[model samples]
Target: MVQILLSLSIFFTSAAQAAEKAGMPQLDPTTWFPQVFWLLITFGFLYLIVEKIVFPRLSDSIEQRNDHVSDNIDEANSIKDQAEKKYQEYLSLISNSKKEAQDLINANKQSLQSNFDNKKKEIDKKLEEKMKEVSKEIDDFKKSAAGKIGSISTEVAKELVKTVSKIDTNNASASSIVEEVSKKYLKGLN
Candidate 1:
């Protein structure tokens, strides 16, 4: 296959050479050089326009777009960083606030406990004082009642003795004896 393709390529090239030799006009160097120079100039101009004007503009636009994208990415990153910082600060503040609140609650509990203790102590003291006052009042009442009963008993005894003896009830001797006995009984009670 390669030999066949090579033979065909040779045959076609020979036929093209024969045709050129038979019919093509000979080009003079002076005339052909000028045409070549013009072609080179035109191609150079087109290449300059493409390279210096069109290609540069396209490249600048691409660069601007890339820079804009990069700047946007950087700004987004900065924003994300700021958000993270704010979040951390907020968390710290909340933690501090919670600690402070816990401390305040503990302090309040202690204060309330102290107040309750003080109140209990005051109440206990007041109860003791009331008990003492009540006991004193009861003792005073007992003494007054005993004194009244003693006086009544002495008067009844004296009346009975006077009635039984049928002597002058108002005699000085009888009165003196009754007074002495009453004094002895009252002293014994004391």
Candidate 2:
């Protein structure tokens, strides 16, 4: 700040001296050549510095930034493509898992159906055997009852004969005739 103030004071002092000596501050024809010469020198110096140093560095910085932006864009595009591939892979995996699960369920269903059929067949076979046993038992009971009925009929016939003839059947000795009559009557029933 102090240097800038000192320079400004010197410039104003020079300008006041020229104004006093030339009687016109800036439009004096006698000083025009020197002012034009200094102006040209300042512009030439500024132009040389800008062309030699500032412009090349500025252009290099701009190209570097552009290259960085381009590389970032390419990387982003590549990552997007990879993400799309991964998404397709994930979808395929889900589809395959569903198909596998369905196949397993179908196999289990078939196995269970076969097992159920086997159990039903076994139950039917057991029921058939039990029915045959019950039928045989019924036939045996019928035969035993027929034999008891024949003996019961003979006793009844002997009692009836004794009652009507007023003779004691125990002394008549005709039990064999009653047994023959009972057998013949039983044969007629068959």
Candidate 3:
């Protein structure tokens, strides 16, 4: 390859020198045929190499890269769809959990209210029973004290009569007199 490049340079240098001596041979019609021929050869060589080797390999590499990009995009889309589905499922689960929690809270509140009502009723019943027992005891005390009040009033009257008269009185007459006075006092109080 080095020898061929050296020979080509030598030939081009000689041709350039000869064209200079021949009064600018590039414009001369006599040199145009050879120049055109070499131009065609170089163009044909370049065209063949590009069409058969470089172009085919470049196009194949480009197609492979495009295919890889398309596959990656498809995979990403699938993953995105899956993520969306999972997100929806998670939302559904959260909603259901919230509903269940609310239901539980309502149930607990209702249960507590029922228990409070039952306890209130029990307390009311106990208070009523205590009140009834106290009233009955008061009635029994009043009944047992009735005779005692009468005897106490009779004794007080006899003492008063003795103090006023400074005289001994007949017991039967004093007793009857005390009875009549006691009846008048009880009536006035009523």
Please give, for residues 141-163, the per-residue lDDT of candidate 3 as tens digits: 86566456666656666677778
Please provide, for model 2 over 160-189, each residue's C-alpha lDDT reduced to its tens digit, 9 standing for 90 to 100: 877999766762345566556766877897
Model 1 agreement with the true structure over 1-190: per-residue lDDT tens digits: 9999999999999999998786544555657877889999999999999998999999999999999999999999999999999999999999999999999999999999999999999999999999999999999987886666656655666678768886545545555666677669779978
Candidate 3: pairs in clash = none
Alpha carbon lDDT at 93, candidate 2: 100
Work out candidate 2's RMSD over C-alphas. 9.0
Q: Clash number for every model? A: 0, 0, 0
The global C-alpha lDDT for each of the candidates, from Candidate 1 onward, is 0.85, 0.84, 0.86
